[model samples]
Target: MKTKLLIIHSSDELYGSDRILLQVVQALRDTYRITVWLPVDHQDGKHQLYRMLQERAVEVQHMDMPILRRALLTPKGLVRMARLAPQVARKLRSSGADQVYLMTSACLLLAPLARLAGRKKTTLHIQEPWGPREAMLLRQLAKFTQQRIAISQTVARSTGFAADQLSVVHNAVPRLDPANPPKPLELDADCARGPRYLVASRWVRHKGHGTLLKAWSMAGCPGTLYVLGSAPDSANRIDVRGMVAEFVSDTASVKIIGQVANPQDWFDSVDALVLPTDTVEGCGLVALEAFRHGKAAIVSDSGGPAEVVDNGVDGWIFTAGDVPELARIFDRCTASSLAAMGEAGLRKYEEKYTPERFDENMRAEMPGALLGS
Candidate 1:
């Protein structure tokens, strides 16, 4: 019989981290008897991840677990966590699994609880770069997990995991079907004629929507900038539409394509992707998505995206949050240039960021105990 593994995840959305969680299950499903626990189901009916897992015949359960969020840091939240601790501990103890895997840093709070519940072979996957204050607290909590897996070197360093305990596995996405070409987006004649760029990410403050708008305006709105994705129901949300209104005089130059089920369709239509994150991005899975679709990226030198792109080769890397420098890059990029860069990016994607490569790396790096060694 395969070793039983319990995977606890914080969210149920089909975003970057959530996709990686599904990929993790795909990588280990044959080797392990896996049961995934999500903290809650999405009320918005966006249950893509859950459905995908079910399609693979993986058992998934939803429960109210202690997930670390900004709201959970307060005095009231602490009281709630204290209240929930015993209940969560009891659940962990009752889970008849040989190993426990905490899917994201948001699930870090469960580390100590898992340990106390006698789950010695607990692993934590650090998918985000941490700020100093949170890193300090997370480091303390991390001590309880026997193994740590970070998606990128930048994330691994930021989370402060020891070399002995940590493994850096870069993220990858499923390859797009070449036969099923994407349909072109409906745009005005003028907008269609010029180079089109895309910025596909959640409307969060740190995602640099403001900076990108500032730079786009400074560059005289050279081409159509398509902003995809909407802000999650969170305190850190940015009024992306309002920011575009405040920055650009020509409303037609910047189009807000808010929240789509298929971002890859847009990825295929655009010349290049621009990820202007002001803070350290965990892995910038969007860049990989763009690359897989044979598209170039203009990413900030904040974290993992910088490592993925070879500046001036496959893609351009500008200093994070430098408006003038980003403007300069925008002004210089022509359709032909972006197309050539995109070709190089496609090669890089095939060589490094394919799903097969990710699965191989994951299987090789997975803890020996989980592999029945």
Candidate 2:
């Protein structure tokens, strides 16, 4: 019988992480039986990956758990996880999976179940650095797991995992289909008085939308700022909306078109992309998305954005949370300069982020390490 590998993830949301996981699964379907476990039915759960898996006849198991929003630290979540651990462990062992792959460090409780299954039958794919308590749990879990794959070098260092124990397998997604037709909404040359700027990110305080708006308004408010992503429905959303409404008084200069099915629809309308996040980021899918669209980016110099931007090569980087520095970049964004950077961005994306490259990487680094051993 072929070896079975179980993928344990907390959620099946339509986010970058989930998308990447789906790509990896699709690539590996010929070799192993891929079973995905999720804690809840995500909003808009009918994602591209979900549909693709169904077509491939892959198994997706959803376990009903009390996963409240922003309740990871609450006692209720901890208790529920404790109760679910044994049941999940028994099922994982009964399925006869050769290895249990835990996708997120947030699955501290689930790690123990994988560990109890056997020392050689577990592995972990960690994306972000964990807190002290979580880190301690990760260390304990790592001892039992056969291998640890870190998404980035920075994240690996921050997690305090043993240098030898962790291997960097940067996240990969399917390359944008160039043969696919561009969105119908074409850009009007007259619409852009200055260089067009695009940003696709969730509306949250730490995402630094306020700073981006402030910088734009301060830089004489030239160019159109196409802000994508839905304004969050949480309390923070109200504050973000108020701030954006106050700063973006001119509808022509700035527009907040909430979430689109495919952001590429508007990507062609922009000259460049920008991400001004203050807090630590995992990896900015928007930056990669911009690259896929052949658009240059100016991202904050922290978190995953910092790692992606080549600082004046394909794109530029600014100080995190520094509105003045962001404004300075805005001042330098001329149409000619942006066009040159866009060309560079496309070159870089083709060179490094292609689906072919990702398949080669996994075949070389992940097969025996993750699924075989």
How far residue 297's Cα lies from its native spot in candidate 1, in Å, is 0.3
Candidate 1: worst-modelled 10 consecutive residues by lDDT: 364-373
**Which candidate has the highest TM-score of all?**
1
lDDT of 1 by residue, 171-246 (tens): 9998877787676776556455478999998899999999999999999899899999999888899999899889
Clashing residue pairs for model 2: none
Candidates in order have lDDT scores of: 0.87, 0.72
Cα miss at 76, model 2 (Å)? Answer: 2.7
| TM-score on alpha carbons, each prediction | 0.94, 0.90
TM-score of 2: 0.90
For candidate 2, the lDDT comes to 0.72
After superposition, candidate 1 runs with Cα above 4 Å error:
41-45, 178-181, 186-188, 191-193, 367-373
